[model samples]
Target: MMTQNLLVELLVEELPPKSLKQLGDSFARLLAASLEMQGLMSKDAPVTAFATPRRLAVHIGNVAAQAADKAVTQKLMPVKVGLDAQGQATPPLLKKLASLGADASVVPQLKRALDGKTETLFWDSIATGISLTDGVQKALQEAITQLPIPKVMTYQLADGWQSVNFVRPVHALAALHGADIVSVNILGLQAGRETQGHRFAAKINPIVLHNADSYAQQLSTEGAVIAGFAERRAEITRQLTSAAAQEQLTLIDDDALLDEVTALVEHPNVLVGTFGAAFLQVPQECLILTMKANQKYFPLLDAQGKLANKFLLVSNIRPIDSAQVIAGNERVVRSRLADAKFFFDQDRKKTLASRVPELNRVVYHNKLGTLGERSKRVLTIAKAIGLELGGEALANQADQAANLAKADLLTEMVGEFPELQGIMGNYYARHDGFSEPIAQAIEDHYKPRFAGDALPRNPVGVCVALADKLETLVGLFGIQQMPTGDKDPFALRRHALGVIRILIEKELRLSLDMLLKQAKDAFAAQLIKENDFIFDLKIFIFDRLDSISREQGYRPQEIEAVLSFLPPYLIQVPRRLEAVRAFSDLPEAASLAAAYKRIHNILEKDMKKGPMPGVGSVRNLFIDIHFLMEPAEILLFNALNTIKPQADEAFEAGQYTQSLQLLAALKEPVDAFFDSVMVYTDDANLRANRLNLLTLLRDAMNRVADLSKLAVN
Candidate 1:
């Protein structure tokens, strides 16, 4: 019944820096989960995860040496099937008892219980507890099997014959309970109290962890390593900050870069290194990217938010004199910077317009033609959108920008760093003597590339960006290459979200239906046959919109009500949602919503039943004042006449909240009409008139959103 803290470690070759944190966390989480599920530990036990370049470890608090025995009851079979006329054991009962390690001798002690509709025999027994040795073995194996390894490596063990698959070759396994070693094995390594650390910088060759609680302290002092991932990352941050402060330069903040660098070193030593200032002559984006991506260095920026000549490198070893480390890093970065400068210089020799023809040779998609054909389609869509947004002047600018947007894909710099495709195009377009708007548009056309990214800055950029996204969506959907589940190869979801953000956030007055139509028309020359793709594309975009709305904290019913109308101007959607939300708060909202539901159901039923004998056609039925005999029907008709104009005026003037609020005045008459008047009265004329009156009320109420959707019942 004794409990103590436990420590588990896996020593191996360097892990993948990008996924080290995930692997460590998963290993700790899965191990602790298995122990708790086996009743060997409480669910609330404290757990700590440690990850370095060479190891993954976890410490769990209050883990038991063995799980407590549990009493269990199990259903056997129906009493009729298990018993005979003489009230004795049957063959089926005896066989079931044997499978459970029991025999007919214990049948007299069995109990009977009602299960569902039948009386069944039940067996009760005490299940033996599992010892720590068996429990830890099972837990360790479960953790290893469920690890999210990015890539698996197959290597031979020490025997030179048996092989194992792992993220890296495992050299040692350590597991401790208090001061005692736990008997467990994985990847052909037996558990022990000793683990290797900081291959070169460790104060001791092999760290002998004294106990579960001493693992971290011993690794830090004797092993010369900071075993915890977060602690080491913080230390690196502290050093970087102090160093940058001394130089009066700000550290460029990139969490992903920081995590990767943290995973690349066990004993992180932050050192300052610099490249030649002349490299800054190239675009800062190109220089910064090369340093971060190729060199895994953090570039410092000056007060003006410009890249400085200095950069920071995280080294795994600390030496008395750091000059050698700094110089080596500087030498390596200079070569990378030189390559970037070369590409930038060579890319400028040819104009972006000159490179346009080369895109024909670059395959975009085999089914969708080359980048050249795609660019033409984009240019057409952009120009049309521009004309609609800003007349001929904007259209010409959009045309010029869209035509050169993809040209940079053929440039040397972009070829080396595809992340800089639109970026390099801006520089090339300016060097080609194009106007600032055109150049800027060429760059901004790929704006808002990811979630929460900025949108295009100017009208021309907006036109081009929308056109570019639309072409991708329509063309791909046309090819039936729509994204299914998590596999969005072309990132259609991102593109769709970009379009929705641009339209809604920018408050552009463009029509969604018109934009989709224009995008589809651009592909006409490609001779691509069309199906329900336009409709499907709309649904796709709307689905993205629904997700965005939900993230913005709108209720599902509220979103459904507004989207059900399929408003053409996406700019108006937020306003419509606001109106619906405001209307729901009104005291009359519930009654009116319920009345609308009733009215909708009545109209639906009548339409489905076809026309009455003397009713002419129900579809075209209109309320005639003479047909309004009942006072409730007359009162409702009079209310519509009085309220419709005011609501229509407010709606036309874009006062959506005011428009929906105006309908609140009709709740009394709507309730009275529904309570008194029978929509399907025996009198044919009266029934048709009442239905028409309800239909008119429905139209007025739904100008903002479908109120019936808000009906709770």
Candidate 2:
């Protein structure tokens, strides 16, 4: 029953900064899960993962020296196959027993159980537990093999002849159970108690870890390395904040940049450095991106959220005199800033409007033609959308915006930093003395470049954004490159969702199907003449809408019921869902939903039996009160007639919830009719009349949603 904590470390050259966190997490989980599966550790055992630039390590508590022995019952074969008619052991049974390290003497002790129509013979035995060393080695191998490494490198070991494949060159492997070394080998390295630390600042060359539990503490003290990735990140954050406060500036918060920097260094020393203030004349986005992406520095911002000339740097080594480190960083950043400033100055010399002709040379996709052609298609779609949303003035603005949106692609600044595509367009457009709306539209056309990002700020921007996204989606789909199961290389799924988000969130009065048609029309010259693909593309958009609806917290039934109608206006979906939800909360909701379902089933079954002799449509027959023998039938007809007008009025007035509530009055009459009336009477006319009444009931109930899809309970 004795247990001991274990520690494992894989020391290598610096790992991929972007993948370090994922690598460390996967290594710890895979090792722990493998141990638990082998019964060498409890399922709830505590584990801590450590990841530095040079090492990946994990400490697990309460790992057993060996797993517990387990009783196992394995079915050998069917009873008839294992034994003769006399129920005695056959030659086959003897062979199986021998293979299991047993003999005929144990045959009578076999257990019998039913398995798929025949009784089977089973052998029961005690499986010896795996020793900790063997289990740990297996787990370690699995953990290493299963790491989510972005890329692996093949390099020769110290022996020079043999090469190993790993995320980085393997220099050391350490595995410990309490204070004892757990002998194992991985990536051609033997298990040990020593690991290298910070390349320059380590107090000792090979920091000797005393025990499994002392690994992190010893590394921080003797190795001069903060082993825990999260701990080191927090320390960096603290230092960055303190440094920023001293300079009366704010550090731009970017989790991705922070994480990459955290993975880049072991012992973080935050230092403030400054670039020439003249670089601020260029857009702050360009400067900030260069600092974060190229230099891996956190750019500080002034009180107005403008980029300050100064930035904070995370240094790997802390020194008594930090001036040299600060100056070196500043000097390097000055050069980067100078390059950015040059790009900006050169780009402003030519207006974005003048760059439009150059887009003709830039190919967007082999099948989709050049960026110029794509821009033309977008301009057409944008103008049409604007004309629909507004009038001639809006259409003109949208057309101009779409025409110039891709102009920034040819600019020096945008060519260097593609992330600033739309932003650079806005700046250059303004520099050309273009009106604010047109400049803003040029930028806002790509407003929602990501999920939850802002939508276009004006009508012109909205039109252009829709056009841009629709162009991508329909063009790709038209060429039969539809997205399938996460392989959307062209980002068709994002384009679809972007379109949906704009339509629903902007409350634009645009038909999704029509938009797809327009997009397809724009690509008519290049697109294959496919008839059914347009509908498929619409379904793709609807799927994204369904995802959005679910994310908004509506019940699946509510979403299904509303979407079943395929409401012509997607902007009205939220209102329809709201109405359905409100109606579902009514006291009479369950009965009505059930009755609506029952009526639909009855009508469908009647149609299957063939329509009545003279009736054009069974669902459209007129209700005859003379055929209604029961008082309940007459009462329900009167209730339907009474509530239909009120509901219709409220529905027309855009009072969706009100319309649904008005239908509640039919519940009592409906329940009574179903209970008392014999809908399927022998007389054809009587049956037809009943069907007509139920059809009316179905239609009235479905105005807000297909109530039948709602849960009756």
The best candidate in terms of lDDT: 1
Model 2, 166-276: lDDT tens per residue?
999989998999999999998889999998878899989898889999999899899899999999999999999999999999888899999999999999999888888
| Distance from true location, Cα of 639 in model 2, Å | 1.1
User: Please, what is the TM-score per model?
Assistant: 0.96, 0.96
lDDT tens digits, residues 131-206, model 1? 8889999999999999999889999999999999999999999999999999999899999999986788889978
Local error of candidate 1 at residue 562 (angstroms): 0.2
Once fitted onto the true fold, the runs of candidate 2 whose alpha carbons sit more than 4 angstroms away are 77-108, 112-121, 614-621
lDDT of each: 0.91, 0.89
Give the runs in model 1 whose Cα sits over 4 Å from its true position. Answer: 75-104, 112-121, 525-527, 613-621
